[model samples]
Target: MKNKYNLLLSLMVFLFSACSTKDEVNIPSDVTNLRAEARAGSIMLRWDNPSDLNFLYVPVQFKNPLTGAIIKTNVSYLTDSLLIDDILAKDGEYTFEIYTVGEGGERGGNTLQVSCTALPRTPVVTEHAEKIDFQVSALSANASDPTEGNLANLIDGDLKTHYHTNWHEKIPFPQWIQFDLKEPVEGVKFVSWNRNGSNNANAEEVYITGSNDGENWVEIGRILPDELPTTGGAKFESKMFYKQDMTFTKIRYNAKSGVGGKAWFSIAELEWYKTWVVVVDPERN
Candidate 1:
């Protein structure tokens, strides 16, 4: 019988070679129109590649929903876009995944999850108030008294001009005065007045210092003459208030001793105050 027709043609060629090796895999074609964008520490992805031609590459995966930590990458199907910044700006959301990879690494059709959110690392303050000016050699009297001495007449917001420091030649006993707040300044509030009447070259052992490079000085308040106040004219006013907001750019009014035993030291007015904090970063817009 021709060997039973050659064993039925060899079992029909072994059932067509087991159905062609079980359909030889080949799933691949899912990666199109996915998008995301949540900046401010980063998160930006986009996609649309898989016209299949055996596409080949686009595996990206990133999940760190609080440390399940897993981050892989491979997006080059001609790059659609991706920029996930290392995660963690107080982290609260992140889990992106893409698919479609053929050329044998076959993994396609459905896997494009996305959910990102990051934009708030805190930053947006603004305040402003100013009053600090006295420039012109930035005054720095160590001994004035050239006839109503002019250390810019003690900041010129005048209270009847006065500021005599060198009684014709006598500069002993810690006599000082400095200025230059050209910049740097923190919550400082100082005010002064004296020399409007007879307090005998007033300005007793007062000490109010601050510096940001005039050689490290930092006291910031002190007064004497019995803390001023003697019945009106606000008693030779003085009001230092630096609640420790240190950040001076320079301001020194030393005067260790004066008041009758006078070696020279007086003032009519001087003022200072600054408050300008502006920090904004609401995702840069």
Candidate 2:
């Protein structure tokens, strides 16, 4: 009876030990569908969480291609995305690796790896039209009406209004409008919008010129007007020109002709831009 009692006690101890070992052995699930995106100065990473309930967190590793510096981050299981910002480095490829961890601290067998390139930082470009003043050579008149063709309409940000050359007095070719940017800029870009709806008065020959003091101007770019009339009902035509880097405070548009020889030049809107650059560092501001 004593030996039988001892055998039963040993059996109970062995069963309890087996159950505890099974509970402590955690199996981690691998993360899936890892994706990466490149922004202006950062990279965004995303991945699908493991379906296993034992998932606790993810360990992410990033390596700088140039310096080989490794960065490690522990992400909560609840989040599926992360943004690594302010990566200030020369344009080059970078690498990433991800490992999933289980509740019991077990790492997944499979590791996710990805690569992305950092583009060189360039100057930011911003619109500078609102700070400037403008003037036109002539204002078009309709049946002795003068309110429809003011030069201010060009920069009012309204496509419905327009600046038109004087048609009542037969304004000659080479009609022009100019803007004073208030300060000189390193470079400039122009986005010009033609009259909307069916009007044959859109400028056909457009010339962009720039000057420092509004006197001796230099030709920057030109757009020859389309000779053929558009078949669709009058729609606004937009054109863009990127000028070389130079110091200029004034920009001028010289229109030589109108679509279908309408003997008038009209502009619906205009936008101006200036460029700038930024430097970045991953470890510092």
How many backbone clashes are present in model 2? 7
Error of 1 at 121 (Å): 2.3
List where candidate 2 sits over 4 angstroms from the true fold: 1-24, 29-40, 43-57, 61-86, 90-98, 107-123, 130-172, 175-203, 211-217, 223-245, 248-252, 262-285
lDDT of model 1 at position 181? 77
lDDT minimum window of 10 residues, candidate 1: 229-238
lDDT of 1 by residue, 1-285 (tens): 999999999999998888887687777677777788887777889987756546678888877777687989997777788888745457788878788788888787788887878665566686655777776588787787778788777776667777778888877867878887777877555567666655667766677788888888878778776776432124343443353556888878788887758787677776766655678865444
Scored by TM-score, the top model is: 2
> Model 2, 139-188: lDDT tens per residue?
22232215456766877788878777777767677777776665676555
Candidate RMSDs in Å, in order, are 14.6, 8.1
Q: In order, what lDDT does every prediction score?
A: 0.73, 0.69
Quote the positional error of residue 64 for candidate 1 in Å.
13
Q: Pick the candidate with the highest lDDT.
A: 1
Candidate 2 weakest lDDT stretch, 10 residues: 136-145
